[model samples]
Target: MTDTNRTCFMKGQGAQPRRDRSQLPPRKMATLIIVLTMLFFLAAAHNAAAQPQKPQPERPLVFVPGILGSRLVDDNGTVIWGDRNSYLNFPKLEIAPSGPVTALHSDGRLVESINVLGPFWTIHQYDTLLHYLHSLGYIDNETLFVFAYDWRLSNFETAKQLQTFVDDPKRGRLQNGQFDLLSHSMGGIVSKLWMVKEGGAARVHKAIYMGTPFQGSMNAFETLSDGWGDFTNFIAGGLPTVRRVALSFPALYELLPTYDKCCRLGSPEKYTPLDVLDVATWRQRDWLPSEYRANGPRGAAFERGLSEARRVGELMRQPIPGVAQVMIAGDYFDTGLYLYVPTNRQSWRDWNFRRSKGDGTVPVWSAANNFSSIEGTEPSFQQHATIFADKYLQNKLERELLNTAPPPVKHDVLGEIDTPKHEKRRLDLARADLSPRIAEPGANATVTVAFEFETGVTRGDVQPTAQLLQRGAADAPITLVETTTDADLAVRRLTFAGSLVAPAVEDTYRIDINVAGQGDHAVFLTVLSAGRRQP
Candidate 1:
């Protein structure tokens, strides 16, 4: 059968048992009327469950977390804010331990702390994104479902688990009664692999991927090596060969080839098909991996994954069927300066680039489908700040998703420019200026900036955009100022006007301007003097 027909069939199957509230018996209706009359109620309750409720407010928001869905777990082994079968569930939150509970690895080892599992929302702690979204007014309580799963399982196995949970008769029902997926990084690949391999895609309505290396990551090889021990520890926490292969880098890369042969063919025995709504490319601090000097040297497998990721990228150049993909470029760098650590060997010199937004991990060009979409916005500067705790970043991202804004078009207008001569500069300039005189509380300041593109850059060649930020003042929540548009692909002039309210005091104010399109372009940014105000 056709993929479209299959999707329709699956949705119909899941939506069958809903009761018809409109077809009540005359006696039953009389009883209901009496109950409402006694309470002085004037309107009858609509049977939304029976009559295909709209996909809004209570829209299905499936959270496909990275790694082993550890973030959805609680101290008492409850699946807090996740699928029923997850390590923790919302109901279990009441009995879970509180006040500094340590997580026990699958192997029975107690971890004092795991930095990999962020402190605010660690592998064992849950609901950072959901809470942030709530504060942003994006979603109401109980509107999101965290699909937490063990990452140490093979793609095939992971797909099976997801399929079972989604296809379950009692669980997995949306307002409209269809599954929605939002997977990050490896989770995206696994979700797709399952849809095409294990026959799960037939049930999905939308699949949104954030910063997923659908093409693969060049650093995957190195990361996989380092992660082997961690994966071993996580997979029931042991060095079992079966567990090792599940997180194996080479094995993950081979999934594409395996599926192309199996399902892409025209056959009754083929797996389900993919119907993705949006694919978002997200990158923040720690997006890139540090090259470890300890690993005897890179291996052939690492090189192979890098090569394959690049190849996959080439394959994704064209759009897929029933799928519309958009790219999001974040240029809010907040990491420290690059601290160069030289190798101990006197004869050999290798440096450790310790800094925020390093190019090695996720370069700005690689973060989105088309960098030109955000010509003037700077990704390097965006990489400086991490969104681990910023409510503005958290809410803003969800807003973008809920709005369903199309990916920046090739000729989309970014914004206009107006700056003073004092902030202008020539080509070959490395650093720009952020005027201290314009100091304002991040939450209540109006910012205006000017940029001088090098002579080599033409107005039509590369689209340059600007980002204005207010750093943390004392201790206040970071707030994002209102703006005209999410991207600026065409700006022509010496000065630019970037008007937005300063973020909350928690964010330090700064200015970043990046060239998003083609051609060799260089520019300098200067924050025009402005008064700071408390709102």
Candidate 2:
């Protein structure tokens, strides 16, 4: 048995006849079993080592979205602040007069791009940012984290919530106990609060702000004082309830421009400076949304809000040098710079806001953290709501985040005009009119849009894309039915026709008649999706 075992086990691969275990002695069988067992364990260990391991992030990332970016859900996980019907019942989101922020119940928060009008018309909030993060090897719930809070509440409360979120071992806290931040718009304020106030700067390695209203924008006053430029009118159908609900959000008040002498108390030419942070100033001007009149907020209700805004504004003024930060601003369109208060407490609709180069929402000065210089100018012909979706900026951001950027390029920026006009994006926007502006839901309908542009603006350069807006990969755009252009006249006339099945979500459907290199001219069509026809 010993000779057979020794001969058969010789290393060089020659076949040997199989031998029965029973024929071998007990000691030999035990030795064979041990050898085989060892081989088995070695193979198992090798295979286990070969399996791929999940990659860990160097500095884990925490994505913070702006106001209206995070989806608010009730206790039952029913989404309240997303989708088409979200603003239809705007009163449901309102805070009570002199009531605690806890009056409204938005217990659950989801970090996702909002489905703005419907599944097809998604506002590309942070989905693209998230996708880029994932492509860079950020793992979900491990290396990558999302901080979603109810933006309607004061940033003070939201900052406290952010503190709680980061400290949780399963979320913002990683192996290294450090994370990077990507905050957009109001999210930047929330991040700053957590960093400066809540001692979060120690844990944050870096932060990137996109189109943030650091100094603030005059649009906030426009929203509350009068629905002058309020886009909510399109959603809520010019309801006073929209303003009432917006007034309830203390956080919105914080967005009111603290710089640029927020409002002139008297006439446009000669006026006294108004303390925008003062609730009394709001009251004296009779500019509150309480009664839907020009009267300011009920003194008691908005004092706390104004206080919150003042505290936040002070915090924003202070610099936090410990944490590294990068700020990106959009300088394409004209944005609200200052408010002009007319005599007799005139309605804000008449000569509302003086404008300057901004991103349609935030002025360039505000977006760059109040830095008014050439280097701080990251000029892009982009709008405030869509800044994050820019591919060129995204590339720059990737390099900046990774510390792989080349020398910064110098731009010969022309200084903002001294007396800027209260003009919207100074682009030759095509005026679009939808023919037979109504369609039945779920049925294929012929949709044609006629666009009129200034004659001097080059033609064929403006290829009008007609479709419902959404993330690139989510859905196919509407099929083009026809495209035509007329000979140059005083106004260049271009036409684009497309085919689409009417969405049953809402009666009002807008086709984004966006001319390339031109501004948005949305054409709304009435659909009997809700069985209530628009008269």
Candidate 3:
């Protein structure tokens, strides 16, 4: 054996390849083994890193209720239950980031029913909505943070408290998307104050205002006994408390910095009363340029309110901002209706001031941010959705009204107005009526009618109907297909077939069509013709 092999032989053990280093020093070998082990581990880790990581789930949603309103109900009719001091309690919506959060925020304690109820006529009715949404499986694994503040307090004070909650140092570490806010009436104002003035906007993703009094309500001033206006001297002229309130449009306009030419004087009636309560009343009020803008001391109050509103708005203005705003408005139900009178003081009392589909306080125009002078009919169909307590729908409607919805408005922003955009929007054509304009010259011709159905929330098979109205001639007669059966919707392709009399030529040949919703849906209609058209 060679010298190396001889050393191995002398040890009485066959020598392994020196390249293998089986006979290496213990510490060196151990160190080499350790290095190889680490290398293996590092390689394994790198390979593992090459694979894709699992996707994280969506963050939970947050629900912020409007004002100090509670979502509870009690036998006593108090919307909020009171503690020993008659203090109020509220409910909240709690959705876990990974599970369902079904708690509603209350101004006070949310557990007891004794302090709930009585605030609004629709308290319990509204709570039923929460139960319904829960049944729909919307509250799962979501963290719903319900915030409550004393809205009865000044807006500045309430806003500060909300700001602190959003700015809490621990808040930054929490993993979640922005909260979705749903507010109503005074709650809307409170939210605006918080989001804009208090920097809550940074944390909010969306806000929905329902029947908020962005502009002062005439009803507020009207509620004062007729003599209350006479006390302008007492409490420093109309009570500084009342004068400084930003509830009404006249008051709010004073807070905003940007008042249009109409607001330059004081009264908003000059350009348009779109933001004010009872917009129709302006039609009857004699208006002039001088009455439009603020001028004197009374105007000073107007300037104050306008400035505040503007300041609140300024906080919201940002490039690619985080928050979305929406407003939902209701038209007064009895606007044009007549009322009966009981006595002189009640001279034809028209409580018709209340909105038909609204919360009895907010008028459609005033509730919506119509002050932008955007020329279009506001959507009047939101009442249908509000009947259900889906805060999402409410939020959408409110945002659309405020023109603060996401890039594209999903809510029914156009009530009955026929704008170009509205015209282009696809209608769920549920039914159609195809009728011949003229009996024809006995030439082979036909009219075809087709019907279909569609829905925004559901994707399923749909069926519709087609109805026909035939007017033989002006002096001849008119016949409407009066049938209560679904068969009345059958498609008709009228052609000059056997024994089919050609349409008679007379002074006028026409067909009228009327489409109605069927089943559990409202259907839109579209008609097309293959024969001579009628004017």
TM-scores for all candidates: the values are 0.40, 0.68, 0.38
Which tens-of-lDDT digit does each residue in 1-535 have in candidate 3? 6997787786677545345545788888899999999999999999999986532212223333433343332334444323321221211111222221233233432222222112211112235444543443344334334455443333555567666655555555223445556665555666777766556676666676655655433334233212123222131123333333222223233222121221121222332212322222222332112222344224443344445655544433322257666555544121111111122223112222211223233434445545454233233332322322333343333333332233343433222212233332222222222333223444332323222222121111122222222233232222222222244223211111111223433222222222221111111111223232232
Decide which is better by TM-score, 1 or 3: 1
Please list the residue runs of candidate 2 whose C-alpha ends up more than 4 Å from where it truly belongs after superposition: 1-57, 97-122, 172-175, 225-238, 266-269, 289-298, 347-351, 403-535
lDDT winner among the candidates?
2
For candidate 2, write residues 1-535 as lDDT tens digits: 5976767676335766556756888898899999999999999999988986443345778888888777666556666676566655455567765563333454435445444344333444566677887876777787777888788888889999988887776662544666788888898999999899998898888888888888888878666655532344555646466676787887898898887576776766888777878756655554555553334445455777788788888889788877878887876555778787776655544536777667778877788876446265455545677677655566556565553344344332222211123222223222345545555677666656544432343334334566764323343366554365445434554456777776655445556654443334344555554444342
Q: For candidate 1, lDDT tens digit of each residue in 1-535?
A: 9977877787888855445677898899899989979666323344443575322333456666554344344457543333323221212221111211223222211221222211111222225555554554444324565555644334555667777756555453443455556665556666666666665555565666554444333333333334333322342233232223322333344322111211111123432321110111101111122221123132333344334543444443444444333332332222122222222321111212222222223323334434334353223222211222232333334544453433333431122122232232232212223323233344233333333333423333323455543333342222222222213213322333334444433222334455332111111122222331211
- Per-model CA lDDT versus the true structure: 0.36, 0.65, 0.36
For model 3, the stretches where C-alpha displacement exceeds 4 angstroms are: 1-62, 71-125, 132-142, 167-177, 222-322, 332-359, 372-535
After TM-score superposition, the amount by which residue 14's alpha carbon in candidate 1 deviates from its true location, in angstroms, is 81
lDDT value for model 2: 0.65
1 or 2: which has the higher lDDT? 2
C-alpha lDDT of residue 399 in model 3: 34
